[model samples]
Target: MNVAFDKPSPWQRIQPVFQGFDLPLVFIVAFLCGLGLVNMYSVGFDNGSRFFDQARNMLLAAGVLFLVAQVPPQRLMALAVPVYTVGVLLLVATALFGLTKKGATRWLNLGLVIQPSEVMKIAAPLMLAWWFQRREGQLRPLDFAVACGLLLVPVALVLKQPDLGTSLLVLSSGLYVIFFAGLNWRLILPVLLAGAIGITLIVSYQGDLCQPGVKWVGLHDYQKNRVCTLLDPTTDPLGKGFHIIQGMIAIGSGGVTGKGFMQGTQTHLEFIPERTTDFVFAAYSEEHGLVGNLLLMAGFLALIFRGLVIAAQAPTLFSRLLAGSLSLSFFTYAFVNMGMVSGILPVVGVPLPFISYGGTAMVTLGLALGMLMSIAKSRGLMQR
Candidate 1:
């Protein structure tokens, strides 16, 4: 019954794995990963498997990091179109024969349940970056329009699936590629102004305008309810408004120093909904308080800033566009999730990047970081 304990040779053990290392990108990912572990611990204490699952996810992410790091940025660019095409086909399949949950069809089944929209998150950026690379020195209005078309196709499909959060993420990621490709600010300024005006109009006349059959054409009923809930959580405190009210209460109850880890009354009392998933932020806030929240935000900011620096230093247009879009996409994920949980934004199901608990999201984020690492490592190699 003796087990083989003999260790393999050093090269056999390490050569395939550690053949190439991107130090800066690896450090940034490891730091964010450490923060995710802490946040998961805070929210997942009573849930026996979540902590272990998170650890397993981290290992899987590291493996992704290694695999993607080995690929050159040019290779990723070359794979962009076929990858994006496959992703779109999957999205179409999801719409046709997908699994529906909570009234939305967002996942496809091929022996395993998978979310096709997550693939678009990566594909959108990759595809746009590839487009920009082709038109690098000759980027023109038509090229920008084509890039927009690339973004709009997947975004429209996702939005049709009625997954607003993911649709926005995909849209924003593609827009980041456009911005990085030297888009005209004159064109962007008008859109921003119009958006601000639209927000003002919505908030000003929300009561009458949102009272069913309003002029707003795109928003779904549940989406409208979430916005209304954000405006005034007390509107239906015990029904559709329960999530925001409880989340705010949990966050406020944390006070200055917090109730300490695993000691949060609201969380342990089971008042917070989605405690281990989208609203994990509220649980973390309740346990860690303002000080802890600030620390968490600071860690996120550091990661984003480092990512942008990597993007800025990337040698090629494709690498820069890909890195920049991925970096900003991370920012969007944090902002949207925190804003929703804090009642400042509509409740769209955007996970808080690495911190929130979900296997698909964690893997998508790992893939993004791997892209950034690929860009960073390429730049490092070029400089040498």
Candidate 2:
């Protein structure tokens, strides 16, 4: 009366690890990664191993995403405080004795050079989400104020390092969590209105404000130059304005159907600056045209939509807040990168996600996608 038992085959043993994964999300990421690879071959062929390096970066990121996805939402919540604390401490260390390249002190050497602010991109939102989750049934204005304090600490530190792009990203991540936590619109409208008013004033008086000796309050000289350059690139056609001007030309030359792959004159002629990194969008636009841009935008929109769906179905408050914030964080990255490249926003150090060639940014994106998948998997498990 004994029953025979058989050992599981390799595929059978590994099957459970793949279960509950969000397939739609995986498909979207693969689609974007495919675009990235195609783009690198065209724009980075002569950049000395950029194509292969990007390929390797993608593989590493995939590994990170897979490992992160295995952790449940509860364990993620437990790691939130420690991550945020260490991120803030690293920012402090960066300020005190960090390495500086091209006049910005944003990287620290902890046996390996690292940008601590990137850590805040995820930690800020996680910390805020954790705060709200702790007071889930008893939220108050004071709790939000405490959340703001937690957010602004890292933001101010990063700003002190004169890294406007990273600081804005960190601020937006925390703000998204706060908004999702039911902060009243009455408290948000005034800030938006004031920002609008400030922009109008800057636009109306650019001539006077952009003077050689003009010192804008709360902005570094380089930051002020970027804003002024955005207002009028013609003033410094060969200097500060060269990047925007070249970027616009490449994008405009792409037309409706593009110049075809690797046929981008502007890209091949080296007219586009940072053609594989921050300005990669311009190169992509030139080679792929408006249709390609549309498809790329649609893919990003799908990623955001799926993330929101996962957030809506998450089992806990922390999961919902973190998922929702991370989803919109992708929106922020795409919007800011595209806007800056299109000349609608000032040039910054932000890189286009998945398409841009940067090891650190790719890893950050992987961590975010992994968390989203983890939340999605948790929801599926609960349903059973």
Candidate 3:
């Protein structure tokens, strides 16, 4: 008797590709991406073929998420050190003979110019998490010191690149790793208090500190300008403040329900700066209004909450720390961008995550989400 079994259909064969995919996380991401595309169409209608290009970028990001999710946490842990080492080496090389544009030496010209700091966004947390996991039960003050040293080296290098946004991100990523790895709140309280006091002092002495020829300590000229502009944008209305002024105007002009999609005067008239990039929140605010803003915030909240849940469920310390850091880092990116656009924080040129148009950033975000998916998937596999 020759009995031939039927081959599994292609759908069945490929179905397992998404077998452990987190449905809620996927929905949240897709929802945010869809909203992003809609807003991009409105903001970039006359900015060339950006909408199509963004569509392509989204596809690319989706592909990255899928491909990366396939890698297990054990494998990711294995790659952490090498990835971080290479990233740091690239940053050092950039410092030596890197490409510079607009006075910022941030890109590496290895045939195709690339920003090494962007890679450190993921690498920093990965390396820190892996380190903490190795010392798991044997963690000591010295171990924490070593971990902070690992983190600061890359962060300082990125800052030397003069990319404050990336520096803030890398800093937060590593901090989250430490925080998750059992850093005591006794230590956290002092830092938070110091930050609060510093802000108070800055606000109190803004007039004196922001005077022409009065140099602010530690901050670069442009960095000082950003803080001063945030304090009082009218001080440099037509110069360094134009972007903030335009952004605030768009956000306020949206009223309660917005001007109705693509109906924003500030957006269509190009009154908003960097409409499709750093100031995307302004364009989105102008077109979508409060209702749209609420929905967008809701999407981000969902993503953040889901990430924490995944971290809570992670089967290993490495997964938990890395997932938590990446998730909170996403929230930080959104909150900082929104705060800057609304004139409450300094304009550090960070994009609005999924809603902004940029291939490189989107790819980074995809890698982040992929890591989260891998954690979720690993949990599922162990359950089975």
Best by lDDT: 2
Considering lDDT, which of the candidate structures 2 and 3 is the better prediction for this target? Answer: 2
Model 3 lDDT, residue 213, Cα:
86
| Model 2 misplacement above 4 A | none
In candidate 1, what are the lDDT values of residues 1-384, reduced to their tens digit? 989888889789777545445675577677777877877886786887898899898888777877887888989988999999999999999999999998999988899989999999999999999988888788779999998988999999999888999999999999998998889999999999999998898899988876766545787878888887788888799998899989999999998989997899999889999988889889989988999889888878877888899888889988988998998898999999898899899888999877888888888888888888888778877887
Name every residue pair that clashes in candidate 3: none
- Models, CA RMSD each: 4.8, 0.9, 1.1
- Local distance difference test, per candidate? 0.87, 0.95, 0.94
Task: Show how many residue pairs clash in every candidate, following the order shown.
Answer: 0, 0, 0
The alpha-carbon lDDT assigned to residue 302 of candidate 3 equals 98
The 10-residue segment of model 1 with minimum total lDDT is 16-25
- Candidate 1: list runs displaced more than 4 Å: 1-20, 213-215
Lowest lDDT sum, 10 consecutive residues, model 3, at 210-219
Better of 1 and 3 by TM-score: 3
TM-score of candidate 3 versus the correct structure, residues matched by position: 0.98
Model 2's C-alpha root-mean-square deviation from the true structure amounts to 0.9
- TM-scores for all candidates: the values are 0.94, 0.99, 0.98
Residue pairs clashing, model 2? none
Candidate that beats the other on lDDT, 1 or 3, i.e. the better one: 3
Q: What is the lDDT of residue 278 in candidate 3?
A: 96
